[model samples]
Target: MATTTHSAARSGGVRLHVQRFGTFLSNMVLPNIGAFIAWGLITALFIETGWITTIGKALGYTGGYGFVEDLGAWGSGSEGTGIVGPMITYLLPLLIGYTGGRMMYNDNLRGGVVGAIATMGAIAGASVPMFLGAMIMGPLGGWSMKKLDALWSHKIRPGFEMLVNNFSAGIWGGFLAVIGFVLAGPLVEAFSTLASKVVNTLVDNGLLPLTSIFIEPAKILFLNNAINQGILTPLGTTEAAQAGQSILFLLEANPGPGLGLLLAFALFGRGAAKASAPGAILIQFVGGIHEIYFPYVLAKPKLIAAVILGGMAGVATNVVFGSGLRSPASPGSIIAVWAASPPGALVGVTASVLVAAGVTFLVAAFLLKLDKSNDDGDLTAATAAMEANKGKKSSVAGTLVGSGAARGNGPIHSIVFACDAGMGSSAMGASVLRKKVHGAGFTDVTVVNKAISSLTDTYDLVVTHEDLTQRAEQRTGSARHVSVNNFMDSPRYDEIVELLQQTNGAAGANGAAAVDGAAVGIPGGRSSGGGDLLSRDSIVLDGRASGRDAAITEAGELLVAAGAVDGSYVPAMHERETSVSTYMGNLLAIPHGTNEAKPAIRRSAISFVRYPQGIDWNGKEVKFVIGVAGAGDDHLKLLGKIAEVFTDSAQVARLEAARTPADVQAVLGAMQPA
Candidate 1:
């Protein structure tokens, strides 16, 4: 028989090992380690006070106990614990949100708000539909601000935009929270139950020896009627309760298990382990929330296994020693447990904690040493090489254009355009350039109109009117720049057209030379009426028509042709209508895409329509109608850029009075790159 290679089997085994290790580290070790430390601090405090005995009596136990009997009474009765407990609980969520948000979005405070909103929304929108809705809306608030900033850089402060965006995001977050509370609570409980069952099975089968210890005690505590009635019952009551209960009942709780988990983390977790572990433990133990130590255990799985083993030992010790606390194991703190239970409960808690801490420390120390040796052998040199490569990649872009000699490569392609609102000139310029490149016609072409910030390094040649050049240059990093004069009549325009002709001519010549019998002549001669280009149905507005009249006519014609609208739309043009227009900052006009109607159009599409003679709009004669159609969320970038171009009052005046399609094109050509 041929010898069979077990490559697949070996790979599967390795993957299984990694997954198991990863799960232990992420789910058990990191989180619980912090919880353990917190528990330790709380337990130590409880040992000092005879609080456990009093707590037992308050819960209906009659035995001699010196501590507080009612868990609820302690807070209303004592101001110190009340303030500390609530404050910690509230701050923990915020801290988590802040940290996560900062990590993801580069420390933007608004991102923290968004993160908080997202977290809260996640909690509230527990139902499937509500969750989906919140997720969808959550990004909108942040995204809208981003869009506005992109559209109107420098004109508006980023901080103000973020504030507005976050405020809106908060409202949506609240809605999401409500949904989550209603839908998620039951689901979370169900999932927790399922998880508990799985954990129990692992313990029963000895598959998870370490975790079994921590979980088993809790399981038994939850099931025991004596512990539940004597401890949990009284603790669960509100301050207004009329309870005649035992005075010295035992709750059967141990703080050491939780504290030991934290010590385990400090021993093995990476970076600031010593510092973070204590803080993590304090929060988890007193707060009764186990999530605090999650990150630590997640940093190292083997360490978590050890911590879990320690927790099991601690819990087992408590159970065997009959050290049960009254008033439940809640608030996980030593003071709360001691004040609420019998003396034996305190002993049980102490013994369990010591055993757990001892086991975790020894196990974690051994693992850390082994891990250090492996890392030293495998990672030191590789890490240094990676750092070097990253540095080189970061500087590549700056190196490309450091010298003057590299700038002389004349732009490979030239583009020309026409638009209704000079406001959209920049957007149209960018869009056409992008489309042309997508068509594979010109890879290194320059796109220019009145707006220039739309230009990117991807372009080599730029041709635009004089007004937008300064702004354009700033964006393009002082790239080879040229200004157009008289629009089409300028020397730059002539040069560009000549370049196009030469390129086409050369291609034609090459094709002719390659084909032996092909005719070396133009296939379609210039037509009589300026050919099909001119004959393609022009909607001419009267030279004396109002801006609204012109806008409505243009919008109707374009929409009807595109099959997006029915019937004529009378444009809503009024006095000062185009004065402080959407073209305020950019050479743009925010004319209605079409008159408002039922069954709205899906997206905004611009229609380029020019007047042979100017019409007055907002005290200025308007010659163009750049129709703007928008719905759903705002496209602030597009609007802001349009406003920027209109900032040049002289350009608007020139555009309104321009004559002929070619002349209109030339005026557009004359507007500088923004």
Candidate 2:
């Protein structure tokens, strides 16, 4: 039945659509992350006021490290210029072109070569290295190559295909390269000049801190790469060349705001968040992986305000104290920030970071006032509800009708990991799931990562972050959708694993064998008329239990009385409850013993109990409690049946309204096996 919702899971609201566009922009820069880090390292070590220069000078006085001093001198002077200039002029363009080409068509060399050619042309025509030219020309060149290939592949003679291919590529490459040199050169220069002017104006006018209002929010939305590599780095490069340092380096590279938010969550948050926040703080602050803090803020979106305030505080502090970085910090780590801080500006940098953290901590603490006393059950329930209500999230087995088009049916052949930028978190997530899938022995299932625009109806399942759920669904026509609030810690993977197992099992059997839904009697036998596993003794018209735990115990007692399982199963069920709520949605929950308690089952049976007043199955209201006891995989059929029942809201309403044990028996009898 999947999970029933109070409202349909809809996608493609104006905000989500805007996010999709932003995500596309981010992806253009994301594939070149390794290159950015390399550039950052070079900029940090070789610039005059950079870390290497300061360290080399200090060591030279202490130990006569003349070679180190000379190296720093060369790095800070002409040698550094020789290195950084060619990097932007030649290598960066080629790398970006190749990646952009591959993004359009996987395992194709032609697109990459074409893109590089175009970028080289752009560089030749430009006065500067033309970083933005590479971005535009690379994708343009690749897409052009793909279109040309499609046009020529079918029409050309088979024997002379290679000749045609080579000639066509050469022709296109030369033309585009020349075109880029002519048109892209002037266009890139104009853009770069305008961008630099705007940034310089802001810094000159003392409005540099106000940039955080945009930077902080964009970072949370996974646009850090776009803002950093695509925009700030170019401007920073020009400024660093002139003044030996640039405040632009600190714009997206500041980790203070993220650290502050994590600290607040660590101190004042509840459940998994509180426990996870400390580790996140270490990763974000010390390790300088700012991506760690992104999910934390995403979990509670209001926390973005705190990060913005903190960023503003840090930027303002940098401005007041005249603290600037010789280069951009790669990971935005505190240590990296310190290393890049100008001479005698370490104190100012430290003060800025501290103030930012303190301000963010206070704001985040006020925003995220979590209750420490909440139990695991409540926490799980609250989290589930959040996922359920998340925009356009649905399983293939069910349709969540709302504003979006109804999704296609699926046996789930292909799984896609989608995000704002396909290369970042989505790629990592795909690898994680791919490993899990291989471990589970589903070697045939294809797992891929892609940007939202790249998604297609051919995919069976789409896993995406909560913030991008609607946009993902909007693109994933009829594909089963699942969203994770914390991409790092998605328990839903366990469910997907189970589904895969079932899928494999069905494939092996080569038959759509039926699993029982509402069994009433002993294994391989039914009661005279059909009300078998669920007898009157097992059926409770009015549950005597006041709470979810008590109701589960009541159901367990009935199961034991029916000889389906023994006394040990009760505690086993309780323990399972602690790990994950058994709530399956549609006012229904299927509570059962742990996997270790499989031996406790004497025979397969179900004890159906109605809790009219409703016991809190975590935070969800569970009216129907089906306590199941089965020896092996025998219980799956019954679970499937229950899912089917839950899918039909009318059927669930009928079952929920059933008054007597006889009426409940009738409801169970109505579920015929498939």
Candidate 3:
């Protein structure tokens, strides 16, 4: 096993899982951002204490239209129920509940119906708007109906299928409605009471600024939407209804910290990070794409301190002046912040943004000046880290710095669009490329789409969305990887067609290069037939480690002793962990060194250690640490097999239960060509 195989590194709750959860929370709010904006505008313009009151008096319409009483129903004596009250109380919650249910049941209408029903009950039970309650019960109702149907779906009589489906959903929805109504009050009281108490205590004690310690780090972990949409927004809405505005909305959505960090980089950074800084600033400050700046902090972990201090400064400024926005600033853009500011609060909000940015800039500038690390500060690697954290390639990051280097200069005749799910965007992208290829008179070229996890090293080129490009490359490393921002309409489509034409012409002149699509940049095509790479000696039953770095060191040390990689490669493994986590979900983390350390590999090999107690890997729990060493650019097949194994929860359970080196080896054997 000396000349043979393994992998390691990556997490907060497994980055993908956290990101998906964040996405789920944001999805419930993002699609309805317009409705929110409208509501906010109406409240600001038509409230009895709002702008319309002053404008109407000046226009002498104070006596004419009852717009004051009818619309600005903020207790104008006549007392007409306004649009604002009903929209927040009923429309918004129902919309969120329905969307949540639709998503849970794979976007089925039935799920939406049940979800809305459940949400109505929760709304009735709670005194405030039931946004959080809708979030909870909507998915619960959908999941319950899904489980209920599975029980008797197959047993239903042929003619009564539709009848059963309708009545079942109704009956289950009503049942859930009652349950929601009963639980909503307790759930709200429990969460709101605790949260409100903490916030109130912080505000009263003048310690509200302290929240940045947790808020800043959590935002970097891609939990901004969950913390904002799921927690703060609901609480903020309640506060705003009671007292004109709430500071809770400003806590996470303020763009000042990110702005300061980017400005510092633009002024005093090195290499690609410095160059990308100016470009990132536009979106970070104006467009409010806060994600654009995360990679910068991740590249320089010390930068977190700057953002935290800046965040504290801003919160303090806002607190001192009682400055707050009328509505949530969805994008965290400066423009949005000002637009949503209460009548006379502009000066306070302005001071907050400026003070935060100034403090952050000063601190970050000092850090950058004192820095001696980062060999030219590789922003590409940092962006790669961001992509992993986000579970997709950031369009802004890719545009700033992302290009695929082809391993060959030969003709291209085969292309594949691969993704984890194997369908959706991959299928559509493949169809687009197929049309362009055939239209350009290169019908000899074939384009197909499939799941990246099962791909063979047979394609000449692979086209994938920037986020998916990394996983796609792991499967087909030899393929020319083209990363595009959009599938339906990408400039890369035309460029790819043009590339094929040029390569085809060159191959026609040099016949040898045209023999087969795989002839150029093909792998050694080695397939493990069980026990070729992993063995009993390489397996640790009850692995010991102090933490993530320690577990990685242990795995790498095992590979070193097995003669798979040079001792120097172990340090490189540590370096890899600093840039990106290797956690691949299902409690498995494959730690491997950087490409620069590839020369240290003796041959492909794997070292497996099962830490039953689980190690903390960048805030993610890791039960299995598998170290990998791929020789001669050979990783796809071995890594793909491991990915496939960990994907199945049942298989993961079996591996978790395995107590012996032999038992672990038996499971690894299942990954062979069988």
Instruction: TM-score each candidate.
Output: 0.30, 0.54, 0.64
lDDT of 2 by residue, 1-674 (tens): 33333222233244355555555544555666566556545655654555666776777744543443343342246433335445655776678766666445332567788888888898889776566787788778878887676553433432454577788888998899999999998899888778778977887898989999999877765556667876776667556545656788888888889888888877887766677677767777888877666656656667788999999999889888877776567668998888666665777888889989989999998887753353234434433343333323323111111224333343567888885434334544565565455446565667777667577666878888665677777666467778764333357766776777765453333123422222222233353323345566787867766666667777888888887888887777664554335565567766777666767877777788887888776677778788877553334344444544555677778887887777765654566643
Q: CA lDDT, every prediction? A: 0.39, 0.66, 0.74
User: On residues 1-674, what C-alpha lDDT tens digit does candidate 1 reach at each position?
Assistant: 12244775675566445443333222211222243224223332343233454455558766632242232222335422432222122332333433344323323445446545554544443321121222222343233323332332222232343454455557644654454456543464354345445634653564533434444233222222223322223222111011211111222234554566567555654445554566666665665444344333434444556656666676556546645443334445665555544444556656665786677677776777576432221222322232222211111122211233433244355443322223333333433233323233333344433333234544445544454454455445424456542321235444554554454332232222222111111112122222211111332333323444345355445644544334332232211121113231122333543123323444333344555554444344445555543332122233332332344466566655655454433433343321
Where does candidate 3 have its weakest 10-residue lDDT segment? 515-524
Give the clash total for candidate 3.
Answer: 25
lDDT of 3 by residue, 110-181 (tens): 778899999888888877778888888888777677667546543444345567889999998988888888
lDDT for 485 in candidate 2 is 44
Regions of candidate 1 where Cα sits further than 4 Å from its true position: 1-304, 314-355, 366-670
Off by over 4 Å in 3: 1-17, 54-65, 74-78, 154-159, 372-375, 402-414, 417-449, 452-674
RMSD of each: 18.4, 21.8, 16.8
Q: After best superposition, candidate 3 residue 251: deviation in angstroms?
A: 0.8
